[model samples]
Target: MAPAVVVIDSGENQEFEGKITVYVIVCVILAAFGGLMFGYDVGISERKHVLKNNYCKYKNQSLQLFTSCLYLAALIASFIASKVCSKAGRKHTMQTASNFSLLGVVLTSAGVNLEMIIFGRIFLGFGIGFAIQAVPLFLSEIAPARIRGALNITICETPTSLIERNKMEKGVKVLRKIRGVENVDNEFDSIVHACEMARQVKDPFRKLMKPVSRPPLVIAICLQVFQQFTGINAIMFYAPVLFLTVGFGNDAALLSSVIIGLVNVFSTMVSVYLVDRTGRRLLLLEAWEAILVVIMVCIFVMGFAWSWGPLGWLIPSETFPLETRSAGFAFAVSSNMFFTFVIAQAFLSMLCHMQAGIFFFFAAWIIIMGVFTWFLVPETKGVPVDSMLDKVWKQHWFWRTYMADDDCTTVVKVV
Candidate 1:
């Protein structure tokens, strides 16, 4: 066998400055507003009485519908967001989502009836779905490969914004702005190469069904399902109720919930530093699954915050080939929203029937998630999106399996 020929343009070998510019930081901060809006909407349900007070004559069911309606709208929007992003560009998609969210906010604030509130909620959901789909995709495309993982996690977990679009020219500009990326043309050419390869396949969805695309897709969807089924949302939704059950008063329970919220924010910040340094696979495999299961609820959240908290958004953005990236992310995001709805709706009932068994049920799922991560998820630290498909295909049956140099010469021998 011969060595593979790799070409490097003369200008591509220059050293990077290794400093993040204010422009890059500002863009990331702006893109992260979507996450802030998402958190606010999810948390605002706890204060539905404000809506009830404004409307004066609403039933309990109507209020429930108002609170949960955004998820439903998001479900519908998720299906179309990728298509829109692909056609209009990521920046436009985000702007459109922002418009939708702004309109929803205005309508909800000035609503005189149930119909107005419902429409407002639906619009807000539509915007959130689009923002959720586009933000990470944009961030991943624009970031420098060295710190891309950290940037994606930071933007997902913190308040970061996006650049303009996915076009090679704009992408190159964004990359040039990042520290340690002295040769923007080479990186831009790589993106072009990926896009060219993607162009050969006429149908993105059909391409995704092929062998090379299947593993990443499976890993992505499975991680999403596991993330939701682990009962994070259930605990988040009913923290007060759980506290009451555990012998705390209403005031204490509410205070406990506030403390949990603070923990969530802090943990998310911690993940920003760890994601790039420790790598996504190690964090998911070792941090959560191997250790932290003692304190039950609090510990579980810590594990989740470290592992799935950022990787859930980071991995799917990087896993898919350029051709199928948009559609693939759409599928993953929609699956996340769907399962979130299912778990949020079913958790209380399961708690009622199972009592102390609910935590055990979630524990079982978390164990399965750990096993899946060890076997299927590959280490993607410092890997480029263009080469991710090849990386996935080169892995052993179990991702952690090790082979000697002689055994790993060719694809066939490795398999």
Candidate 2:
């Protein structure tokens, strides 16, 4: 029998030793550009293409499709990204995403017809699709656990790219270099163990369906769903529209909405410094929303920025073992984009029908999100990615029951 290389439950002694290099910081910042690109696509498609651009002339439903197809394309592309992340590696996959965005930009910029606009949106969707899935995984793997949430969560910002691949010796060397340490024996060993186990599984998607993998998968999907159900997209996607309802003039509404977006970015920057210090669960619990005026909108944006927007991507990134990191994130990203599309399509109508009640509608979901986080979500503050199942999930009160038999999952294969 080949020896089973197990990543034991983390304890104080398990901490990896290293200084986070400036090079790693720079790589994380680059990889985080995916966040910027994703925001740009989601924001610009609505603000520029559907509303501002003259070439988007169409009926209301067609215009809605025009706005939505990008997310639809993104939902489909995430699956494709899983394969690419496994084969091409995270850095190369991010480059490919940028290429798609560039092509989208070219088509949209020169578009004289609706088809060109749709094609452009589709391409941009593919760019962000591949980007959100790969970038978070890359950041989590490369960053030190102490600040992994800070670094990985930052990728939800304006835009970024990434580093490292899968060759064991080379991966270790790169890991040590980025960590600015002479020895990375312990950290690298855990990663190797995870990869070895990953190799025994032929289908990551099917494996994800098993009860053993339920905790991380559940957390990933629920966080994504809750992130959107908070109606941050409504506030984000239609801040200007919502502003207009509150009696701001069109110009003032646009300006105020822009302020809300800026706050979103600024608050996420704050999370980069706070997540590791405070831990992940508290950040989610701290979230709240308000809907009074422009000032209140900015406050709401600030709350979401620190909590779900970035943490949605951040938590899912760190939770998955490298074996299923790529594939698992693909589902998380798809859920996010799908719900985002849902909110985008439904918000205007919800606003029309619910009027002042829309705020109450989103408020109800926030209550449930808090309860869910308190009872079910495991803290991944400084846990190593490979040891997450054993250290975090298997130790949680609710999740521990589901993960009780998780130990038997080790698969043996000849090296």
Candidate 3:
């Protein structure tokens, strides 16, 4: 089993709790809003202010150019998010990202023409791109790993891995003949049994103590990147566009956008409350699946009503550990922006042109994400920083059933 973490609780400490810690939590809450603000700023900024009023004077190519500039900026910034996070650390990267976003806001507010607005939107995209990578990772790291996914770094199988695992478990009778093995079932069973035994014999403590490898570190980054590819950001970045496309007038559309922020805050609180209790993998599986369903419904409701307008509730509360938390978070955050860029700039346009296909290419991707998370993602509930990987690698089934006993909860001397 992974060891538990214990924060120091000094009696009558005067440094925090009353006012100081409140500010800290408040800061964290504000920091986390980089996503929400990105949604609000970039999502609707173009529609009411720029696209509707100024772009009318432009030629066809300029309108397209005007619409696409911010996306290109986001794509570039997202590519930089991981490297920046690794080099600058999470908090600093976030502050930088926020400053850029603020700058974007100022530029947009001051813009006198399409050129200035486009420049502002580009900066906004850059700010959001950086935030998507930094903020989620920041929240994931500072918050307990047991509660990381709830804060936002959801883990899912990479589809390819899940399929192989599923085949190994379920396709024994078929795969054996292809491999020319006469005892296919036995051979496969033996492999499964062997891996299980290895997992069982692997000492959680010993594995935890081993040096971190490059592969898991890379995996953490890739997982976060995949998260962005799911296309949640497409809806977020283009909420007003999507609403306007679906026939909502300007006033209702703006209100719809604000509601998204409200819903996100409320849903995130739910993750915060339940993250420590439910495993990250499980929460991710459920949330992604739910999001996927919502996307499908949106497709069905296309041109008629906006499905689950604005406030997204897909924060998966379970996948972070102190060791590589920032790197993993950076990857995931960047990936989301990258994914959103592709969806908004490419897929949606293609589907909109097609006229029959629902702009939900990302929905299928998320469903794949759900499948991967169900099998390969490990449980990190209540696991301490040092032994977190071990608890997952060891595949301890009994862990889910175990509770923190009072006698076992004492803090060990750090020696």
Candidate 4:
């Protein structure tokens, strides 16, 4: 059998062995730029909503539709990104996504009407779709297995870092209990041997490494689908409108919208820090459950509640395995986009026409997401990427059992 390779490697061990090359950090930072742009573009759209609401057309429903258009295009893009990335490699796929984003920016900047605006939005979605799906997959692939969950989780978290050494002290007895060949003594010796082998290595990173696992196309697809459908996009798509309803002026609403973007980025960073130390379950529960309550209250308030604005920052990111990570993420994003188009474009407007009924609709949706995460989502932080699949596939009635049971979850087993 082939050795299962984990993606993450801690910077600590590499200190004497030679520093983590600048190339790796550069790659991660560049990928993060895609995320940054995604945030900026979304913010720009939200600001435009405020501008239109104050100046042109006064709360135009078409603006929301135009924004929704990008997501629509993205739904198409995400479906293809997986296979493309698998074949083309991460760097190439990201470059393609960047080109689309540039196209969208130019088009939207020059757009004169709704159709032109929609065109720009579509291109933007194309870029975002590619970036969103490809970036995380790249992170998971390159990161060390021991820290895969933390690194993968950080791709969404603004970006963040560990303990456990005493175990080495008791290593012999533990290894004996686990058993091995007659000549083998303990894990400590094995670890020391491995370290010595690495130390004698002339150039570790320079060595050509074989592919350890297939790209996580499936997981990316699932993530994008779930994220979008879960009502996150709906919230973002109509943030200004929500704030306006709560008595904030156009400028105030736009400013708050920017704040919301920053918060999303900030909270992502927080998640990165917590994922490794605290594990994935606690963070998901804290985040989604908190969002659930605030969104429900916003529903009750019949206006854009300031309290609910911060809830967007509480999204979870560790519910996926490395193999399926890409597909899962893409899936969540696409679903969110699909619903953002449907809900924000069709339903939200209708609800607004009713004046007091719209809040209830969003409230209900947020609550459903909270319930799903709290009960069904598994904790994935610090999990080995390859082994994650084993645990996930082991359950005979995985979906049915988890969906039906109020208290059931899984975390990766460390061997």
**Cα RMSD, each candidate:** 10.3, 8.8, 18.7, 14.3
Clash-forming residue pairs, model 1? 28-160, 28-161, 29-160, 29-161, 30-161, 31-160, 31-161, 31-162, 32-160, 32-161
As for lDDT, the candidate ahead, 1 or 4, is: 1
In order, the Cα lDDT scores of the candidates are 0.64, 0.71, 0.46, 0.48
Rank by TM-score, descending? 2, 1, 4, 3
- Model 2: lowest-lDDT 10 consecutive positions: 155-164
Better of 3 and 4 by lDDT: 4
Worst 10 residues of 3 by lDDT: 11-20
Task: Kindly report which residue stretches of model 1 are placed more than 4 angstroms away from their true locations once superposed.
Answer: 1-20, 47-67, 111-116, 153-175, 178-183, 276-296, 398-415
TM-score of 2: 0.85
Q: Who wins the TM-score comparison?
A: 2
Which candidate would rank higher by TM-score, 2 or 4? 2
| Candidate 1, 40-107: lDDT as tens digits | 77656544423223121222445556656787788789879988887777777888889999999999
**Residue 223 displacement in candidate 2 (angstroms):** 0.4
For residues 1-415, could you state the per-residue lDDT of candidate 2 as single tens digits? Answer: 1111225534332455677678778888888888888777656644642243222122255566776788888999999998998877777788889999999999988999989989998998999899987888777766767777787632221101111234666666675677677776765665566555667778988878877778889999999999999888777766666655555556766676777778888888888877702677764443322234766777778888888878888888877665567788899999998988888776776777778898999999999999999888878776656566666776888877776454434621110
- Angstrom error of the Cα, residue 131, model 4: value is 1.2
CA displacement after TM-score superposition, residue 62 of candidate 1 (Å):
5.5
Q: Model 1 compared with the native: what TM-score? A: 0.77
Which sections of candidate 3 miss by over 4 Å? 1-24, 49-68, 71-75, 78-89, 145-231, 239-265, 274-328, 359-363, 396-415
